[model samples]
Target: MAQHGWVTQTQNPARTADAWWRDAVIYQIYPRSFADADGDGVGDLPGITSRLRHVADLGVDAVWLSPFYTSPMADAGYDVADYRDVDPLFGTLADADALIAEAGRLGLRVIVDLVPNHTSDEHVWFREALAAGPGSPERARYLFRDGRGPDGSEPPNNWRSVFGGPGWTRVTEPDGRPGQWYLHLFDVKQPDLDWTNPQVRAEFLDVLRFWLDRGVAGFRVDVAHGLVKAEGLPDWAGEHGLLDGTVAPMWDQDGVHEIYRTWRQVLDEYPGERVLVAESWAPTPERLADYVRPDEMHTAFNFDFLETHWIAADLRESITRSLAATAAVGAPTTWVLSNHDVVRHPTRLALPQVGRRPNGIKATDPQPDEALGLRRGRAATLLMLALPGSAYLYQGEELGLPEHTTLPDEARQDPTFFRHNGEVAGRDGCRVPLPWAADEPAMGFNKTGATWLPQPESYRRYAVDRQRGVPGSTLEMYRAALRLRKELRLGRGDLSWVDDASDETVSFVTETPGGSVAVVTNLGREPVKAPAGEVLLSSGELEDGQVPTDVTVWVRQ
Candidate 1:
């Protein structure tokens, strides 16, 4: 492959359809912020089709899109009203078909978001549930229950919403009186579906087959741990455990595994060996292992890896734990750094605060040092990509985009902000539109110069057009690393720690078919002697034959 050019490779490669996802580098695209084709300020299917070339050029095996399902825009499309059709906010079903076709033409596969835990309040079933009254079959499809107080006024339990407030909401009876309460673990606009209902199970299975027929390679199962609740719907005794990985009755129930097993059968019915990846947050790695038990999903996000602090020891432990946990179930671990819901890793790595989730920044909070963060972010990227499994790249990370941390209060759209009464700024900072052109309106995200979320002025420098083809640019660095990762077949291998590494450094060797590659990351503040091998790539500029601070180097041993 040319140093500045891309090498085109077909996905699946006649190398056994089931093995492609084992080590695939899939790119995650949050559609609303990716690009806008019709100048509607929101990214549409056509816009994504236009930009598939960019993802293809990055050498990713697949693109895992966030939801574009028909919805009322509650929870940013996660609350799907219609699972079978595309939202007008994105485009029509035809546009989605075209996107799949275009992606295939570019040697990339499409894995769409599958939101099965909840449905928008506007969904036909939800509306029917409300109209049919308590104890009706329609209401049985959701988690509707009688309230605790006199005349059923108060919620049945003390369960708190993941966003904020009580997880239950009281509904008015058809007789114009206060009535039973319904559960919505997320925003009240998203009511949780009752997976125990046979109707609910059958409906989602059909929804899966409908999309599978549309030529999608797989699904990035949203809230994969949340479909089932413990029997009797008991309330938790302690705090809502959204981030601390607490085992709530509302998540990671045993029944969810059966659901995925059924879904796996549906995927097997397809020709391309379609996959299902869980966004599960179980209480332990062993518990998480249940979701990918060979007959279930293909892989799951390693939140342990993503949430690990920048410390080398913490990262090494997380990586080892993840590898061992998944290996126990004969599955590959999926490594991810940043996604739509969290602060971008660049900014997160710069902060002294190491919260499990990115607490949105306030103007009064200590600002991140961008220079320091970018160096660490690059190093972390190289370290993650060098690991021995599949990897996911969030869009805009290639351009080294930091979170837009200073948006005005009125501009925030994340439901978490409103639910928390602004005590948390919410995740709007990380969902700002991507910068495609340095000077164009909305950073070339939309020709109309408007976006659903405002873009920061700082985005101009990190725009795609500004960095493309620029030597040593973050974009180029990603392209080069991805190309080399494919050439080295680094993703498919076994990884073991290097014994010679110091405490401040995390070192591992990946034994691949082609060669054994050593990866070293110096998290310390001083340069380290280069490992004894031929240097292939470095996250930061190397110093006189040494790895600089906050740098990761790949060595062909």
Candidate 2:
């Protein structure tokens, strides 16, 4: 395989000379679930540092660590309390520095998560603002409004919070007079900052520079679209009365581009090699492209694929739409099949027609055929890594981990569950601690105590130590897929969907400057004739010239 150097300049619009992320595969590590050192029973920076070898061995170019900053854990660290220091629960600032250094030693670039749209109420700045009177300068730092309404009886508007209630919270003044109301789009503890304020914008830009100066490679900006809001603060009409309405007008507001432009300028002060990935939930290609508009985010997660219906037509449409939209904005596209916030892909797409479990749990299972489900899940993994754009592998996803949503009410950690009346169970399942040893207590994620979240009993069958040397294990399959992606130029190539002659199959071809490769998959239950090609790799047992059912084939010509 020939190594392609970064293009400093390019003549073709589809090809960029300086896009470092074009060929990069990023592994996402949810800090509290990845690994726990010091027997804390919760994952921390030191735990992640010790596990860098596992990430590097997968051949990924970088690792994107989900938020580990000082926080109240309201949204699992998305509600940041301190921008410059590591939370004591995770480790000290020194542990973070060591993690960065260790990742570099393994040739893996480290990208930290930055949550700038809101801050934890415990944040010093938010506390100071609350302590100051209405006339104080600190009051302008957040969205504080006088009184509740014109009648002074209710909230100013019927805005609903994302977590399922009124977005506004009224606070009384220290002198016994009624103080102003504060806005929180997610949780009341995570009050939204007033981006309209110049001082607020300047302060966040300084935070960006702070990390860039610390030798960190880049950031995964949380809620990139939620940075700015409609300045009028008008009440949204349609779902205005519901708790979900609070974020309607403010989310993905067009005015956000201005703020992103400012952040891009601040990022430009550093070297061009640094990366910025935005977590925008907008599924449309045009909307997703807004975050990666050449100068804004270096790349944005193309969540359309992650949320796409598990059908051939839907998958093809997502890829085509994503490619066209990214090309229009002169930006490259990145693909993610699973993340901390969503159901695992294996469980999401395993069955042809999967729905909520009988108990109404999204990813939990009561199905009759468990072994078949696991096999199909392995098939989904092959499809995800073979796609053209940059791929994001969630923590423990490579081991075919299924979501564990059986935690009792008292054990549920997600605040969204309580806030939404359990209508939205939240992301607790995907955030469970990773299992390293099958027989060890807590699956070897901890030594002496129980984990912050319960480890699944099924983890005993799929633990890393158990699969490390198994040839056909899910862990080995992941390593092979990743190596094939790198050695065959599938990550940096032109992608085209093949017109399948049969309804039961899905296939595509990838072409790079070096060579071309074709991938075909029998997505059906029955065996299908292999497409005419030289087979490079097969998912199932392959005889001399025959392919097995539910198999994926990679071939080079």
Candidate 3:
């Protein structure tokens, strides 16, 4: 490991299946809020490129950037208007290229988000479909069908959008009459692409090449389980719950595996072990493993682990099931706590009730116990990193930043907020611009332009400048943990449950250099007994040689 945890150029020169990603630590960067290099309040490629050093200092192996492609911002950048180009809001293509080069220079691999299931309404293909009218080749590229009613005024089916409201949006004909409807699993502005259309498949393949040619190490495939739908796009009665429900016809269809097999072949054609990660949601861990079979993707996000509450039994089950399923296919398991799309873990763990599924917190909502949430969050992270697989860190998470739970409704931008008729506040709370300088304007997220999302004043204490070298600070804890994790090769270690584990706590031992290290976590109120060992790193101070509540300790037994 070099200064930035980068391998020397001579290392892995053949670019074979080095499998670096198997145990890698990737940091997800939501560029809209990462940093603003220019005077613009919104973050751009230059902003991210400049601040990447901070990410490198955290000792992550790579950076996973959310969509920065041309978009209408209907669902942030998820409504991608053009996959081959960068959005002006983020910067130019040259800027993207420079960012990739800079990340490589820092020994950091870059992984860009790839939205293959859908395209923005403003995308040229969608625009062409709109102009070409129904029954045309252009219209064939998307899921366009006639309305169900006699007058063709109603939607084609009862399928609901993940963002609420109707999934099928009726489009007027070129002659200006109410015509056929297009399927949009998410926002109305994001129409689902018809994978059955050969041209559509060709276009996305080209998009992958364009970015890979630009020097991105790989892609985080958005809706990886959704490139294909059921035969007739049949009606589904249940509400969509990606992180917590049975698979739907419109999601995790078997046909998706065929697409990934092709994608895997394309990825293997390139050198440097270019990887593909699936952002998939399935009915079970076994089903999720299908997306990462050796012939398909390299890995899939372990959402079951992410959705599990801070319970010992649940966490152990999720981890065991995930590792077993992924191992069955010989693929690495990917662990993540928070991302731009979800509420921060600290806030999620601290909240008492589950009023909202994916919608973020609000000022009017019951506020979470911030200190308790953070304590548990740190404990959870230590336990996660100690597990045997790759891990992902959300931006600002290393600083122990909680979701902006008090963000006013007027400042909200996530489409979920508007789609739910303001009844449910959205993910904006977790996407606020990060606080880099406690004393600077907008916490040093930007120089002059107004932040796309307002930053909470409480972020001052969690600012990078405030915690840079402070002992016991969340940022420093993450740095130390990452350093130790790599030095001890903990990600590749064999894991086994400790005999003394109880219902309230998880106790496991993992093979290390000379012997094995024990990881013990206390989730319940009562302090639990821990195995006698020298403390290597602890999420919190050990109390009287016992593991305190919301604490996780790594000990050399």
Candidate 4:
């Protein structure tokens, strides 16, 4: 690590005036859980448009909508059947057009999710492939191969699904007898596309142009790194330790870079500084940086920091490594804590800090320490906002919501839950609908008193109306921090270590055009002396002029 972080007097060329995504705060909206405008027990495009004011008021630069493409809903909307059209369940193509127009009116750009890795089993291409029988051109578009055993009874390889079953799903041939098996890294409904095929590449390039012409700024690429697999689909003998720095044949292949470079060329053709954000889970920061090289993606999520424990040494190391690595490639780092696919950070951080990260909590599992988690969560958010790069905020995180650990097992809808025989709860907990007001039907999410997933009783306390104007509330704190983050240009600033920080705290000073801003977070159990400066904002109240445990403070130098 550089002695004072990745400090540079030179500005990255990608930070040109219109390249907003480089230092922007993009909010991720899981369409199914954001707001139900139609009162049909599910969120839709109109619902999201209705809620755009709240998102804009939060000072976000853009909104990344999760997949709303026509789907069978087997893996939610991720199993996209049609990339060019909106799902009827999520409204229609007209509704999506209206959504983009309204968002632009509110000064927010839109980035839709693009699932290039796979298509729903019901997609026209897949259906045609099924009808074409073995060795047909349609079958060549996907990873279709003959089964290994007699009568094709076995899967071709030993690859297991990330959702907890065989990666290969056998399909009957056109002649009615059992035939070949196709690969699906996720659910059976989502068959992985063969990116090696030229037609597949051309289709995705067209998909990119289709949305760009409709006014979307860019895409939050779903399974960005998994699109290209290593040659010959090799078998893996090692455990898939997601964060253990293992490189699977199916992820982060070198061929992925060329694909992005092509997509980047399409983005440059547009008027606005279009962007591409990769959700790559590369084994190292250096490898993750490859996706965002000058001619590739604009940014990739920093999972190294997201998976770090709440220890100061580990966090500092992660941050240091991340900034150093990304800066080397002239790409701004993108930070995130909570998302639709994982346990909420507040709950995750409150648990025992020394173990494998929980996939999702269940009623039988040890629950989170709510108060402890919120404090730590708040501190972490403030720390993240003070960093010099772009950030992504998952919906409902601003309200400090935790995982619904007690969600009834019978109501779980994540395919992982079913695939795992209900042993793993999956991600339904964090993806629950947001609560906007107390005393309103479904907490202001809908009028029919229904939600796709049940919200907890505590949701009323975390409702947006309950915290909107209340001082020190999580919502207000976030608003204030965002306002200051932009006013002070913290996102475009340079970060340096605070030499006097103790071992239990991570402290840094950000230098911007206006002046210097100091940020300190006390991860220890006891309060510690804060860096000397005028207190600008804090994640919590100061205790005797000291930063308390699980708290962060921002000060002006």
TM-score of each predicted structure versus truth: 0.96, 0.91, 0.95, 0.97
lDDT of 4 by residue, 1-557 (tens): 01244333334333443468878999999999999988988899999999999999999999999999999999889999999999999999999999999999999999999999999999999999999998888999999988887777888888889899889999988789888999999999999999989999999999999999999999999888899887988888765535567888888889999999999999999998988999998889989999999999999999888889999989988988888888888888899998888889999899898977877999999888899999999999999999888999999999999889999998889999999999999999999999998889999999988998999998899999999999999999999999999898888877777654368888888787668898899988788887677999999999878988889999998
lDDT of 3 by residue, 68-176 (tens): 9999999989999888889999999999989999999999999999999999999999999999998999999999999997898889899988887999999888999
Please give the range of 10 consecutive residues that has the lowest summed lDDT in model 2: 1-10
lDDT-wise, the better of 1 and 4 is: 4
Q: Candidate 1: worst 10 consecutive residues by lDDT?
A: 1-10
Specify the poorest-scoring 10-residue window by lDDT in model 3. Answer: 6-15
Give each model's whole-structure lDDT: 0.87, 0.75, 0.86, 0.89
At residue 378, what lDDT does model 1 achieve?
A: 94
> Which residue pairs show backbone clashes in model 2?
7-17, 160-246
In terms of lDDT, which candidate is strongest? 4
* Candidate 1, superposed: residue stretches over 4 Å from native: 1-18, 242-246, 353-355
The best candidate in terms of TM-score = 4
- Alpha-carbon RMSD of each model: 4.9, 4.8, 5.4, 2.2
Candidate 2 yields a Cα-based lDDT of 0.75
lDDT of 1 at 28: 96
Ranking by TM-score: 4, 1, 3, 2
Q: Which regions of candidate 3 are displaced past 4 Å?
A: 1-18, 241-245, 353-358, 513-515
